[model samples]
Target: MLDREPYADLPDLPRFDLTSEDVTDGGPLARAQLSGIMGAGGDDVSPQLSWSGAPEGTKSYVVTVFDPDAPTPSGFWHWCLSNIPAGVTSLERGAASDPPAGAVRHRNDGGTDEYIGAAPPPGHGTHRYIVCVTAVDVEELEVGPDDSPATVNFQLFFHGLGRALLTGTHEEQ
Candidate 1:
């Protein structure tokens, strides 16, 4: 069986937190003032991200947004990206969809290589978007650029050095 804990063999790395000015509790997303929406403003509004305390020997980073409570058995991927340089610490809003220089955007669950903002079913209550930034040991994985999110995650199993997670909630009326 595949190891469920990919990081089980790696040494413990420092942890970091991700926060945003455009995210808040029970407020209008527009007022949180983040960029990018599924059908709005080019759909490239990446969230602002900042982090600290990456582990030693980290060569690069990968960012992803996952929703475990989606109506599918495999959940959903809102965004997936890899090959972010270690020197970079933040991404402008919509940057996840329109990655910066040298980064690669993987296909989300919708089968498109972009960020699809939360639009949970009318009665699904609230859904959480788990945004994660993984510190990696390599600049790039063995997987190809056209790989799906599952493929990219498979590669991450071996090279992940550490990770940081941030969560935001959304609900549709």
Candidate 2:
């Protein structure tokens, strides 16, 4: 038996499938997109992401990338976006940084409203980037455009109907 909270009162939230061609599980990120500018530091662009099989009642979508292995005990958020139209299924490179109209981009832990590529410490081994696409019941959350990732998450907790997650790992060179 699972010790997690019961969801008997909530709608049956089904799991969706998501994938990304620009990233591989337990693999290294492309050198061109590594954290730290080439010869400086940071990645050049965000990874590509795609998904399918959202629940029938899904009215919108929310995308987020999290790094649990960050130095901070609570972890770090790399990117967050909400209000993606249900018809849309994927995001191209750099989309997280400059999302299309109707979508809202929240500030990451770095205090920037853009995707921050992985930057684990020199000997932290592999760090996972949990990329998620949440099927939401609401077309748009009540959050402001300048809200932070934490605020977005609070809204998501109440609005998410289902979610799909894909994990990619990166290590310092």
Candidate 3:
């Protein structure tokens, strides 16, 4: 297993609260959180997420799902949603299908503008999914819907005011 913390190189931003109803930190992902699109024999549903205690000046939020233990140098981005209204803190399960108004769903590594759940290769051991919420200083990032997750991350590096994260693990035979 790769010992990688995806955010290790990021600036030490203030931390906040992030919780999920369908995914538990350090626990195995539910079948709903696995990838049907990738033929993982499970529904590719995004988990329900909630957060609080963001920095005082936070104007918007960004949400991302990353797989750091992927078999590639750049890892993989499963989801990237940006420009979420600051007042909005919780996302209902399956919200990836219809993101909050004004929020932009950036392209994931799979080239889809929605959450594509875990589908690590069989026999690849376990993989960790880091679900993150970022409090941003600006109302909207410079990137557009066509932009990649890396682009959103780059903007986040500059305008992010706080961050919260939860992790879930999964594997196949």
Which candidate wins on lDDT? 3
Which lDDT tens digits does candidate 3 get at residues 43-146? 88999999999999999999999999889998989999999999999999998989999999988888889899999999999999999999999998898999
Clashing pairs in 1: 35-45, 36-45, 44-94, 45-93, 45-94, 46-93, 46-94, 46-95
Per-prediction TM-score: 0.79, 0.85, 0.98
Across 1-173, the per-residue lDDT of candidate 2 in tens digits comes to 11222223544467899888887755666653456632327564778888999988888898888877777756778788888888888999899767867898888887777787777777776778778788988888887669877777777678887878777777775
What residue runs in model 3 are displaced by over 4 Å at the alpha carbon? none
On a 0 to 100 scale, what is the lDDT of residue 25 in model 3?
A: 98
Residue-by-residue lDDT tens digits, candidate 1, 1-173: 11123334645555766666655433434422222454323233446777778888888888887766677766778788888888877888768656778888888876678777665566776666667788889987766568877777767778887778766766654
Q: For each candidate, C-alpha RMSD in Å?
A: 5.0, 4.6, 0.7
- The lDDT per prediction is 0.69, 0.75, 0.93
